[model samples]
Target: MKAADLFEFPASIPFADFFRADALPWQWIGQIKKALASGFETNVPGSIPPGVRISGEVYIHPSVELPAFCSIEGPAWIGEGAQIRPGAYIRGNVIIGAGSVVGNSCEYKNCLLLEDVQTPHFSYIGDSVLGNGSHLGAGVILSNLRLDQKPVKALVDGKSVDTGLRKFGALVGDQAEVGCNAVLNPGSILGKRSLVGPLTPFKGTLGPNKLLVSKPETSIQER
Candidate 1:
């Protein structure tokens, strides 16, 4: 339940080697081993143009943007100007930062999406982290378990934080702004410049410049 009360540090975004809370009650396999030591990568696509089927220890970048029956699988990393628009479905230790924007039928696993984040259309981010320039509007769905699924804890600033994992999701911070169809449940923590409106259904923390507009009308102001 630590990690400095489930992440808040970002005064200037230099998370050194990325992360390292010394395993203070994290789960999802220590957040996928601190997102594989925070140097996560995976944006494949080196020929397979016939129909598309990238899977060779992915790490694609150079103006990334794949569509056609998308099926990326590997130590995933599609950063630099990311934009996997069509039938998007990324798997494996994901990252997808940079210009981030995974639209159409979006679906990610072991997520991170930092840089200019944006789950464009139908979102389904897993084991989350979506921070930098955040923006998940259309159908934003990020509930990583815990109806009785146990092991999902994070209620920082008021205590109760214990993300020993059972598939923890939602920790959205940075330039947060989730609206349309928003439903970040689990360990939801939209801080820095927060604001969740349309169809909201958030959970735990919503502090820094908060403005969650739904369940009980939150509006902690700051920005």
Candidate 2:
């Protein structure tokens, strides 16, 4: 699906020109690096905490709330008013939009987190796009790589389409909610306002405003 279908590309992020609205959603993953390289201006916080280690080309807005301890490796951008909780690990081509929460113990790489996204605890977000207002429950994992190490294919229109990327994760659409301890398999797509129940291992594409629940048996229900 088109990027516009999933994300609005918040105005708070300066690299919007690199991510075209008409482009495919998965295509936006590859643009993360290019976007950072082209427009990123390094502006770190003035008073760095003792336990927080920041390295490489990074930009942390003045209003970003940094925790006491975290490791942030760059080519990364942390937007205004973003909250970086303790023990967070941010590395490589990461973009955190305004007011987003880079939760405690979260590991992020090659990802784009749009405005107001909340990944509030113990999550692994890599090579994925979390849209505006999306929330991930504790221990949510966006599994990026296939076990076989092959290209990740997305399920579009009920057909498998090769995304051509070996490392790809879920495209969590605007305002979506993923429950605690859920594992989103490689190439998963959660449409806008959709919900994935806790403790579920979800894969493929879930449409807008839907709910995927596993009550001993997995089922898709209208939200």
Which candidate number has the best TM-score?
A: 2
**CA lDDT scores, all candidates in order:** 0.70, 0.95
Prediction-by-prediction clash tally: 6, 0
Model 1 C-alpha lDDT versus the unseen true structure: 0.70
Candidate 2 per-residue C-alpha lDDT over 118-204 given as tens digits, one digit per residue, 9 for 90 to 100: 999999999999999999999999999999999999999999999999999999999999999999999999999999999999989
Compared with the true structure, model 1 gives a TM-score of 0.32
Residue lDDT tens for model 1, 163-204: 677788787766788888879888777766778888978788
- Regions of model 1 farther than 4 Å from truth: 1-17, 22-43, 48-65, 68-83, 87-94, 97-101, 104-111, 114-128, 131-135, 139-177, 181-195, 199-211, 214-223
Lowest summed-lDDT stretch of 10 residues in model 1? 7-16
Clashing pairs in 2: none
Query: What TM-score would every model get versus the actual structure?
Result: 0.32, 0.98
